[model samples]
Target: MKLLLTLCFTCALLITAESLNCHVCANQNCSTSTSVACPAFSVCSTVTLLRRSGTSTTVTVNKNCSTLPSCPSLLGSETEWSVNQGFAREARRQLCCITNDCNMRTLAVPNSVINGRQCPGCASSAESLNGSCNATVSCEGVEDRCFNSTTLNSTQLMIRGCISNNLCVLQAIFGDLLSGSIDITCGAPCSYRMSTLLLTFAVAAHKVLL
Candidate 1:
């Protein structure tokens, strides 16, 4: 009977070894966290999110277990979006690893610097729902693409902004954690004017030479 009890205890430890363990926290500093075992093929992830409206910026952090296949490549990467030039913005950074309790790091949002591309901008509010987005904003940093996003929840909130090329990929993987279940549609490249003008100038010079 004692031998059977010992074997049962060994089996339990073996089962626990097969699962990944990760720290879970949802505070700005991640000062306190709890370790929990994750499901099969899971990885430990730590994410930081920043939301800005005008001069007010709010930062939040969450660390937990994730099953995203792209987690490995997404480590230490950040994405950003903005509306009204710099009036409203959002940024997220993620760190993911496959080893048990490996996501012990924390991330913070980076500052924004304008990159000169322009896009129509509007914040999510009653006025924006009417499609009266005549205002434009200078795109910032790696945010060379324009985007229109609407939440899938009952509120159906809408926002138009500038974003990085990988923002969409992160949104697809992170879902509600990034911005809720958002339906995002990206617009055409916003920095085409300079190229178009250069092409026109080259053509004119060729005609003159002929």
Candidate 2:
């Protein structure tokens, strides 16, 4: 009865709010973009994820309705935050707004914040993106989650080190977007092993500075 009543209330809210309209695209410029109606319970979003090695960087952009709880609406630039582990780093920027088709502007990677933390992990490139865990990393701001995950398919790729909570949500939801079995574990617990030789770590984050 209680659950039913809550559902009823939620449904009433959605009926009043209707559905949000957002842009849906990937790896495209959105300066002058088109729009599409989102699902019954989602919000407009433009999320960008990047992985960098030394001076080389790769970026992927996605615009669609999101159900992520963390990224509400910043209204401005992305938090100049990122995560770095040894040879590789991961950074994210999001532009979200409430209204009809508000995801405009091509967001650039903001300035990085040096929070003075260190971690260890492995990273790879989009091209030959599978490598062994043979690196120590420098953890960045808001990258409170230490990730150690792998893709369990024909081509198994292992990923590790500190990461952001936003990436956690995306990896969980879109782990299988590529053609393979992928496992993404961030800020894991203790240490585990995908196999005998392959060891993974999980550090408990407390009063995490994001």
Candidate 3:
């Protein structure tokens, strides 16, 4: 009887260990998030992104369960870009926590200050391929490396921006673990555009790395 009781106790511990709870929300307001059990091997994730296009700016926050354990390697990374002065320019940070509902707190967006580096910035889609940009963005903060990435999923999207060296390397190392594959190429000298150089890619907030 004692052996049977021990087996039952072990089973209970296993059950508890298999379940993880995390807060889930997609809105900027994460204060009213719902708690739900995540799948086995999943952890809580909080992602904050700030995007700017022309004169418009938006901040977005998301919390959910994630299975990618390597995502935390990008904890404080930021990207900057401008496309013809009116395309989607973004700065993003991600956080991963192992405790239940640990992602309830929202992360702040990182600020963009001219870091004296520059990169070619552009975006394209299958429907409307711009192919190139005449203007280049002066990179900000730790965005010392230039990158070009193409989405391999159904979206058919391509992005070019300035990224930190660590972010670029981590993305390459963990590219296989992400949801969808992205072909990323980094490095290359960014020359100024004599006619169309713009400061449109400046970030909205200060250095708020996760």
Better of 2 and 3 by TM-score: 3
List candidate 2 stretches off by more than 4 Å.
Answer: 1-28, 34-42, 58-86, 95-98, 105-111, 123-132, 166-171, 174-180, 188-210
**Can you write out model 3's per-residue Cα lDDT over 122-163, one digit (the tens) per residue?**
533322244454446677655667777766777655566676
Top candidate, metric lDDT: 1
Off by over 4 Å in 3: 1-17, 26-28, 69-86, 122-130, 149-159, 170-182, 189-210
- For model 2, residues 83-159, the per-residue Cα lDDT tens digits are 55546666667776656777655566543555444455764454226565666555665665566667777776665
Backbone clash tally for model 1?
0
TM-score of each: 0.64, 0.54, 0.59
Clashes of 3: 2
Top candidate by TM-score? 1
Backbone clashes in each candidate structure, one number apiece? 0, 4, 2
Q: What is the RMSD of candidate 3?
A: 12.2
lDDT of 3: 0.60
Winner by lDDT between candidate 3 and candidate 1: 1
TM-score of 3: 0.59
Candidate 1, residues 1-28: lDDT per residue as tens digits? 9999678546544543468889998455
lDDT of each: 0.65, 0.58, 0.60
